[model samples]
Target: MKFTSLLKAATTVAFASVLIACGNSSSSSSSVTEVEFFSQKPEMQATLQEIVDDYNKSQDEVKVKLTSVPDAGTVLKTRIANGEAPDVINIYPQNADFKGWAADGQFVDLTDESDILGNLNEGAAEAYAVDSKIYNVPLTTNVSGIYYNKDAFDKLGIEVPKSLAEFQDIVKKIKDDGQTPFAEALGDPWTVNGFAQLAWIQSASSPQAANDYLRFSDKGAIKSDEVSKNVAAYLDLLAGNGQSNSDGALYADTVAVFSEGKALMMANGSWALTVIKQQKPDFEVGFFPMPGLTADAPTMTVGAADMAVSISAESKNVDASKDFVKYLSSTEAMQKYYDVDGSPTSVKGIDTEGKFEELADVADLAFTDQQAIWLHSEWTSEEIFWDVNVSYIKNKDLTAYTDALNTFFDTMK
Candidate 1:
């Protein structure tokens, strides 16, 4: 079954109108206006509710009715089809094709609110824009890189790798020293494929090569050879490091391995820092850019707006939603979001302080050096890109990789 269909089947309807006491103040003369919010991540739901509670306590004009939808993509789609969707939605670019949805007139054009939009990263704003109009407020941004167990590396006497060849050598050394070199969550196609695609980009002759391959244009196809080579290199790394489980590693399993210190390195986004720190508070963890296969690539990494808030075009309380979005983009809310969520900032000029310092440093490097490429799922079909990568990882064959790319591009044409 298609992933979308599976998600639809798994989704459950939840309706609630209970009011919580936070910091919101209610006035006797103001009428209560309820707006629903749908979110997939439990942590995101909690953070958002806290924000809503604070907002509600500040005023009586608007009350947010938040709902936790585990299968947000499916539930949102169904709601849209039935014309019963929430007033405001948190849409992951991976799940919802922002361009297609905007073209179909599904979102409210947020161009009029340039004051808030101007605070976001230009690339992010463009990604969520259609026909020169922005439709969503970027909440947070995240970048992917190598997260290594410093203690394990020290114990094994293996140095941090600077190049793809050196990376392979380090993994081999770790394995020889009786440690797992890498951890891969193969059961979740997205997680497994992330490694392959990221490796491909990092191995490219130039960052433009990776960009072209993602767009799948004619020029992209020719430049994509480096991508294929990178995939092959990744497969070799997994096979040699004893990281590819025959049963296939699930996302939870991969996290467990890393948390338990069984693996030395894992490639993931900076958002994972909180969980890792919580699980093993004293575990010495260090991060580095994924090493390049060729020196010319210069350590390319992937990043994107972690989440986006879009007002429903069909919202009865458009002004209320707009107000909420503006508040969400404000310095105060963005600061609170960074404090609680630990994600890199999308809005400029916020004080990062001591929160996720490693991630913040890496993010600054990527942004300033122009070494960051937004993750493919941010602008492409997740089903095609993710599935192709997972298949290549499992099979260790290049045929599927080539075929998948050809098929994806053909569909686009």
Candidate 2:
């Protein structure tokens, strides 16, 4: 519970010394099963370890050790490459790496894990479903949107817009008021990448609308369509409306600018709110889903599976890993994670009423199955797609979008 326990997961110990459980449900009466859980979520490391500690103390049958390191993606790839897959892992199901590993049977097939999947709020698990089958245990869900400064909006007498046109008008109104419209940090490709994805999601239709359009529509949709063109135009509008010299601003700089009340809005995921909160700005910050084509459609939140854990299919200790994963599904464990992280719980019964009020509006979209899993997660190479969007944002060229759709066909479809 102290600051020191946060380092519990940052160990370099190999799995060679641990007692691996037999694959079957039953283990030797005298021996305790040792299970490895490699995690990439640094923020939740200690929380996970605390849960592990509780689980370990509750029983002597299996011990779950959390393994985390700096540069976890590379470490995980190397471990799996060397046939040292952790028995359990925390992975984002929407990422390309998760897709590849799931396809290759790196994780256990949880299609029949009704005891686990059934506990989650509807679509929380399905949003990240790999080929309609569940491979990861969805715990907490995160949503993306525009975080607006309440004081700034109040000063300008601005109301939250419910349509794309209205949203554009707000941008113009902010600009006309001689204030910055957005804190877009183009210097950080990921920020631009987030804005691009959110634009496409809100512009196309709504949650599933964006999901299907990107995955099943014509590959040329980005090349020739009102929707695609409108999205591109909006991206152009956003690129031009950012804070002063925003193209060179770092992600931290945007947080600072937005926190200082110099910028009206910031396009980012739910995680950014944490950083903004730390700065203790005078005004209240609120979040709303990116505006869609119409008022009713304005609440589409773009996000994905957050803090999802899965078991390795190739593990020698399947039973032990299952035991650990089952423990994670308990209402107590999920609630512990939800309480500390302030993230919306994917589990069915944890009440999030009045918590994280800044996230209230978008949280509705998140739990009600309204979040569109990040489209890049479905791509063959999401980074390359992100690079294309970044290219468009910087050069303000439409052809970069053509390259994006080409990536959709070449790597995604």
Candidate 3:
């Protein structure tokens, strides 16, 4: 919500200023060139500002102006098409549909820049690469897990559930005892998608399974039985009488429910920790991996770089932009960013204890030799996947859902 609000505010400011500046502009080349950074999260602007301040202090050649745009992917596309695009942009590779953009040569390839590419996490580097060409440099990585109210679990004598069946049983018991089992924000697209993503991962055990379901590839088989069954089970749990929020509460409301201690458990990515801690410092909170669907199935969590900074293909100050990005990726810069934002650093071996202790255990599990995958929306057309998921959840029509998914894949061509 902070991010959304920030984007709207930024757009209003950009629009008003653009109108006024157009009247006074005589020679645009003489003034400080602004490197507009379109970003979704308002909080990220603070981290970027830190880097910009440092960059500006050290050099007089270029001035980097960052603008927070809501729905950055859409904004970037529209601006680029209108020939008013920025020189540098910050976006989630998944949300920005970086792969498709790269295929169309809309983004500048940074594959040859080993200095920037080498500093990123392996998974992040791979995600930022399309057709073996790197287009973006990751700023931070976020992972998803179950956040529980420590006091509630302790009082209920409930250990963190380790398997899906156990988790559902715990939820049912909690409900039977007149307490909400889980807090979900269906209104917030991310919150609804968060649960859908968890279910997708649980149903699709292997990496290949994820690729098949998410990418809609014809090569991989769809475990429709597993996926459909899990979807029904998860929805049944959410739609049960014990949910704290109203029947169709959005994601923000769901988060508020958990932060206010109305629910025992809420599924969210690491970013929620900041808001939770800020709002409920006295509340004891802990996290665990989303329980595995099968005992032997290795646990997999949703993860991706929080933001990737890329040089715009139309950038006039490419060298300065690259320098700025390089500095942003340095160990010192990343440490500061992580400290300020509670974000997990992309640089390997950076100590996280002081800033992100809540995530220490989960982060350890994530970095283990076990494999992980990005969220489904990250690899597919977000509009199609998100719409199909919401429809399936609300309607529970398996045939229609699967057919729509197959049609989505056909459209990808």
Candidate 4:
């Protein structure tokens, strides 16, 4: 929400302000080490800031200040390229960029931080490891799938779809009932980007097929491919049956629409759980992975480490940064984050009993052999595709979409 909230803010502050603030942290008073903390999860900005404020107030040895902004990922790359890495930051270990960053010595190697790593659930930190070497404190896991309004479904005598055809029939039924079938977050390109990622994952026949979908070596291959066409057609179907103002619907708007029963289902990740709870919908939200093409095989979940903590290897305030990371990994701090996030805690000793029961079906397939992770988890220049996904949804032009992919692929090679 911090990211979306910043989009329409009356007062304007840019990511550069963060670099400017942290840039001066080291040169400031020598009484305490200044840990410049950068955050990627804008939705968790307030909680993280509170944790930092508490840490700073509790001691004089280290002072940690956090910065979170819209499009934090791009801002981070810019800061890192400017040679101004934050002392403390969040890094996705499952990401290709994080792997490259660690290999290039951008993060403090934590493979040897046994004590700190020991605080995490078994295989939690290791699951996102780069070449079997831990590099960050993975806090929570995320899974992507369909979130349906149970009360609406029950009223219609609709069961969760087990196959793509069943899902299509349900969509038709909802449309016939004069209701929007899906609350699409098309207005928010980033939200739609996640939506498109799930579509691609659901369209694939195999894990390699999912990966190969983007591994195009030619320009027209995407437009010519049957599976790719299905992915695009599926987007068109959802957008076609989406809310009337879907083009202007932000992530919050789509969630609000779904919460109010204006739509039957919403495609999103586990993070949407908190937003739905905030709305206090009359219906219980039910989650299901994207159905298989024909029930012969169900689609695997696509997810990765949700909130991961790391310290920059090049931090001038190394000790303070490490201290901040240690505080974040502590049981007390972890509990606070989990309270608001409600994500499956990857940290040890955090009680999450019945915390995300609605997401149990997704959890059953997540982080297992049934999981495919995110397509971008291994791509060097994947974020660029977000705009392409947005473009496809708006224009439904297969040529333009494939053209963008071809250009993006050219850069990858």
Candidate 5:
């Protein structure tokens, strides 16, 4: 798989080298317009370089040099402050810093980039829009959920559970059969945050409750019995049946452990499929939206645009940067990205029929249902929620979590 293969290739290249080679400033003889493309996702370094190579080879008018750095938000902010911002940047909308950046007009207003943005998924594009003006065009989008091993389920005579009790039964069965029920990498806050987001969504009593979690401004916002119970249930699942070393496991460990069949399930997104396929090519996998808290309340999905391409408002070469961003939105670029990234594209009319063969019914349900929730919208500062979620996972202390959330909410308001 491109994800695994390219990542391996990326390791051989020094990070400092990649950062130094930001653009084609050294090539004085080259007449092409050189656009510096910056991205925060280190995993996509080699894959993005491939995308840029393909684009440069396809045309001569402009050249894109890819610079993938760490700590995306901090790096981007520093670059902007230093007046050395990349010409085109890949933005992750889920980052809390993006809200400030959008408001500050960091990126060029893309509302008028009709040719590039016209065929995009309207819901996703609208998510990136501020004041009816969009500054970024989504590159790829994915849904977060429980990714499970289908072969293990079939071997154990387990079917997809419709209710939370049934799901817990399957988890217990997996554990009884000498298998790890879940691949939990607690070292990464985002993984636990994903689970926390699902729990909050499943605990919601109404659609309004699910959508507007941030509106609960009271001190008891996170102290409700229902939410505390759900949080406890989630912690019990991880602590009781997760992989042996899951307490200290990292993101790479989760991918390796889950892919190698050491675990039966992973709470993750559609992107894990490719890497898992790469590790165990014949392994069968399936996905389900996080099961609801009880039978009466079934699970619903929350999705947001994971990646988007935007041009720096301060770019010296606006037209060149626009060209690169436009290329990123084209069908060819999207197809290649979807193939490697293993996520659904937001571009309309792009055929993704067998693209998600690993996920059969789960794919259908995600696309057909329109109840898309931006999970991050539940909190004013996502970093605070991440910390609270990690603490909850570590201790299952609902009272402390609630107090922290209330304090954070008070600051936000």
Candidate 6:
């Protein structure tokens, strides 16, 4: 027999034997189909495991074992190449790599799975959709906005600024008071790139401008008056008012600096909330949209489903894997996962109230008028982002940076 035929026959026999055992068994314990679940975010490991444990207890037919890795993208890709990918994989939809996998038929087509598809926020789910097919289900979402030290604002008699002008004034006052205005984690170019994304979103004149900002080729694309000027201005302000060592500090160090009351504000996302609280539980905090051209520029913010869950196309136990996926995508399970993980859910009509004020402040905007694409997730190469943004930061030259960006994407085209 051909190798493919032999493999298919063996898989069928194994699946049939497991079904037979499950059908015939009458004991308290029966044969359990195990699915290997691989998670990319180390921070969510414990929460994921708890959810997995609940799913296991709810049903005896399938058991899911989750393994969390810090470098999830690299590890997951290597596993897939080796024909050893996990049965259930948790990854970020923002990642361009996911598109490659989806196009290559590595993921099970979940378009018809209404139980999973119906519960999702349509826009959020669309981020991971390829050719109108839902390849993965969203797990939870994160908000990106400005995190401010409420205590610092109170002590300095500074109300939360409402406009870009007001925000700049506050930064100036904070600086005049001998405090760093923004605790930038520039040691990690990715974190710096986060600021770029925030700037691009806040400065966008409209959703069209924001969406088109990522297109590297159109004539005068990156240099458009609203997007480029505002982004450059924001970076310039950060460079001037940030920590003395802001350019040298890693993301963790910025967290520490903010927690210790050394900086009054930090440009971060909801993902950093847990670490900040853990670093200093009583470090009073609040959030607001990135103040646009005026305090009135729509008060836009960036947010989306952070990670997604998908089943492998080549799994031996597709039925069991779907069961596990369904459990994770449920409202109850996702809420538990988010409660422990401290991120808002990507599912519509799910109650995320009173979870984090940072999330609550932008709840209306995150779901409505101010959605922004996470360029980091869409950018095909990290090298392009790091090189362009980092160089911009060091030289403070917008033209050079835009030129380099176009040059890179031009090569890809």
Q: Top model by TM-score, which number?
A: 2
List model 6 lDDT by residue over 219-248, tens digit each: 444553556777777777676666788778
Between 1 and 4, whose lDDT is larger?
4
Off by over 4 Å in 6: 1-30, 206-208, 211-216, 219-226, 281-283, 348-351, 367-369
Give the range of the ten consecutive residues with the poorest summed lDDT in model 2.
Answer: 12-21
Residue-wise lDDT of candidate 3 within 104-204, one digit each (tens)? 77677888887876776665566556787888887776778878888888888888777778878888778777888877765555665555666766777
lDDT of 4: 0.78
Worst 10 residues of 3 by lDDT: 366-375
Compared with the true structure, all predictions reach lDDT values of 0.69, 0.78, 0.69, 0.78, 0.73, 0.75
Q: Judged by TM-score relative to the true structure, which candidate is superior, 1 or 2? A: 2
**Against the hidden true structure, what lDDT does model 5 obtain?**
0.73
- Provide the TM-score for each candidate, comma-separated: 0.80, 0.86, 0.80, 0.78, 0.81, 0.85
Give me the runs in candidate 1 sitting further than 4 Å from their true place: 1-30, 94-96, 121-123, 155-159, 205-208, 214-227, 243-247, 365-380, 404-409
Task: Give the per-residue lDDT digits (tens) of candidate 4, residues 186-254.
Answer: 777777655577677777776567667676444435554777787876677575778899877899999
Better of 4 and 5 by TM-score: 5
Instruction: State how far residue 79 of model 1 sits from its true place (Å).
Output: 1.4
How good is model 4 by TM-score? 0.78
User: How many Å off is the CA of 303 in candidate 2?
Assistant: 1.2
Tens-digit lDDT track for model 1 on 193-234?
Answer: 546556757655544566566554562253236467675786
Task: Score candidate 6 by lDDT.
Answer: 0.75
Question: Candidate 3: what lDDT?
Answer: 0.69
CA error at residue 325 for candidate 6, angstroms: 1.5
Number of clashes in every candidate structure? 5, 0, 4, 0, 0, 1
For candidate 2, write residues 193-259 as lDDT tens digits. 6667777776676545665677665665546577777778668667678877787888899999999
